[model samples]
Target: MAPVTAVTEATRSWDPYERGCPSRDLLDRIGDKWSILVLGELAQHGTARFTQLRKRLEGVSEKMLTQTLRALERDGLVLRTVHAEVPVRVEYELTALGQTLREPLKVLTQWSMRHTTDVLAARERFDGRAGAV
Candidate 1:
């Protein structure tokens, strides 16, 4: 077997199809259902509190939301603000890079909404055939 070599970030051309590409990790993060919903909610509503986000995103657990926010913040796609007040306040908003993603995400959201019925029908057909086999 041939040994695989590691490509330095500086010299590596980012190709998501490459086996060791860092882009794959990023794609995986952004492709997550929670992450996509979080980004979409923030993009549409501007800054929001953690509770508000959780409420808006149905079925997302507190822990999952927290992890998503932390990951987004770490990726520079979201900003976390801390305001000192009586009880203190924290809000999440998208940064410039995150804003750049709005259009693409919006398109993806629309596509999903539009194709939902088609996708469900396809899934049913596939499942039916699988069950028969």
Candidate 2:
């Protein structure tokens, strides 16, 4: 019989530079606009209902919100709870794994906010140069 081996940090570590790595897929999910916004809202509010999240996000269609939530849930980032009640209440909150991402996402949000004007200016300059050529 072959020898059994225990998993270590090196074995579980993710190298996004490698093609077809699971981390690449995870990066895509977390880097999406919808996912980032959803995570931000959840991080701030702790927990929220479907309608509440929809209202807070603004401009997000029901289908899109549902899809985003489902994807996050599948990735173990968000927890969905359905309460048995007269009205059947449902809510979503970030899981422990998701909580770990809060700080990094917050930093990213701040960075975007800080650079929005610069980014816009750069885009305008690029557009002008492109039009000149």
Candidate 3:
């Protein structure tokens, strides 16, 4: 196994378009549906419990939600807090870095809401043309 090397500012590449760039992985993390939704929810509502997230996200399974939360927490985008109580309460909130994503994600969400019908029409047109050929 190769020894791990520290990436300094001078050595780091910021271009996500470049293959093998670390930013590509970061893009992949933030670009996913569940991650975007989770981040948006956290940004909107502040802190939320596991069940609250699951209920809001709808169609997300228990396992998928758990995995998504873990990944977000691991990436330092989400902070998980466990309350010391008989029921063992847990909650998640966006970190400062994660908070920065709110605007961009909100833009994307608004674009989707605004253009969904247009996108569906385009898909239909493409499919119709393809069927004729």
Candidate 4:
């Protein structure tokens, strides 16, 4: 579970570079690669089942998706809805707070899309080889 924070709102101390702070925690939860992808998928699709989320997010393992969803839910950013029926069904959707993150994530998406080819060329030049990863 993510630690409950006493501080809220933007302030001078909210820099992510400083160690051991609420801003850092927030970054780890929402700004990491997996979390951003998950949020993007949710934002685009509205509500999705576990299998659907997994399918939408290519290359994500079951464990990572599960962990990300749990963390988001615990932080009150994502809503988890379970349907009680013959076979239980679960779905995930972004809460209002989560929706607020969409614009920031979109900026990241734009940055990556704009720079990915240049980044790859730079990496190739640095390594003197293609596809070193």
Candidate 5:
């Protein structure tokens, strides 16, 4: 056991490219297509099983989902539990740290959806201008 001490030094900011940085690993984990969707699902529905995740995420491959869940579990973001029953069952959920990311992820999702029309308009304008030139 150790006693706690107070200090007054500034903490470093997260840079995703630094060598052996947890931030970089974190970015890699959350930047994947499946990770975002999985996290979104868990945030919305709480704990879920593999079957449920696959069904809700539509079009996600079993292999990819398994890989993503394993990676998340390794990174301490997701928890995987197995139950011994007639047919064996497994569930996944966000840890406390993982839950914290939900707010930012939700904001990012909302931003994209809310501005989809604007994004489409921008794309159209760019394509139209490119064609005109």
Candidate 6:
């Protein structure tokens, strides 16, 4: 007979710095620009239709929005619902798991907003130096 063992957080290994870590894949998914924007919209609005998402996320093409939604759904971060109506409406919302990410994403968004001026100034300085060289 084999002895039974339990897995705990201490026993679990997930290093994003490692080459083949699963956490790296998850980071790639959520770190994408489209994913961040889409998640931000769903976090703010709760539930939104395809068109509503498209409208809110300016410059996002239909294909990109569809791909982002499908990816989020596959990752279990978002829920997709299809309503049986004359027009067959579809809507998306954040799942409980996805809601857990809201605060972190919100903090990142705030940081970006707060640092835009500094970032732009840095970029301008770099470009000016590059032009002289």
Highest-scoring model, lDDT:
2
Residue runs of model 4 more than 4 Å from their true location after superposition: 1-13, 129-133
lDDT of each: 0.96, 0.97, 0.95, 0.89, 0.90, 0.97
Per-candidate clashes, comma-separated: 0, 0, 0, 0, 0, 0
**Pick by TM-score: 3 or 5, better one:** 3
TM-scores, all candidates, are 0.90, 0.92, 0.90, 0.82, 0.82, 0.91
Q: Least lDDT summed over 10 consecutive residues: which range in candidate 1?
A: 4-13
Clashing pairs in 6: none
lDDT of 1: 0.96
On a 0 to 100 scale, what is the lDDT of residue 54 in model 1? 92
Worst 10 residues of 5 by lDDT: 5-14
**lDDT (10s digit) by residue, model 4, range 1-133:** 9997776565345667877767789877887788899899898789999999998889999999999999999988899999997699999999999999988888989999999999998987988755565
Q: For candidate 1, write residues 1-133 as lDDT tens digits.
A: 9999988877778989999888999999899999999999999999999999999999999999999999999999999999999799999999999999899999999999999999999999999999999
What is residue 43's positional error in candidate 1, in angstroms?
0.5
Candidates by lDDT, descending order: 2, 6, 1, 3, 5, 4
By the lDDT metric, which is better: model 1 or model 6?
6
Kindly list the per-residue Cα lDDT of model 5 for residues 1-133, writing each as its tens digit. 8996664334656666778877877787897889999998999899999999999999999999999999999988899989998799899999998999899999989998999999999999999999999
RMSD of 4: 6.9
Candidate 2's residue-wise lDDT over 1-133, tens digit each?
Answer: 9999988877887889999988999999999999999999999998999999999999999999999999999999999999999899999999999999999999999999999999999999999999999
Candidate 6, 26-53: lDDT as tens digits: 9999999999999999999899999999
Write out the backbone clash pairs for model 3: none
Could you give candidate 3's per-residue lDDT for residues 1-133 as a string of tens digits? Answer: 9999999988876998878888889999999999999999999999999999999999999998999899999999999999999899999999998999999999999999999999999999999999999
Clashing pairs for model 1 are none
Which candidate number would show the highest TM-score if scored against the true structure? 2
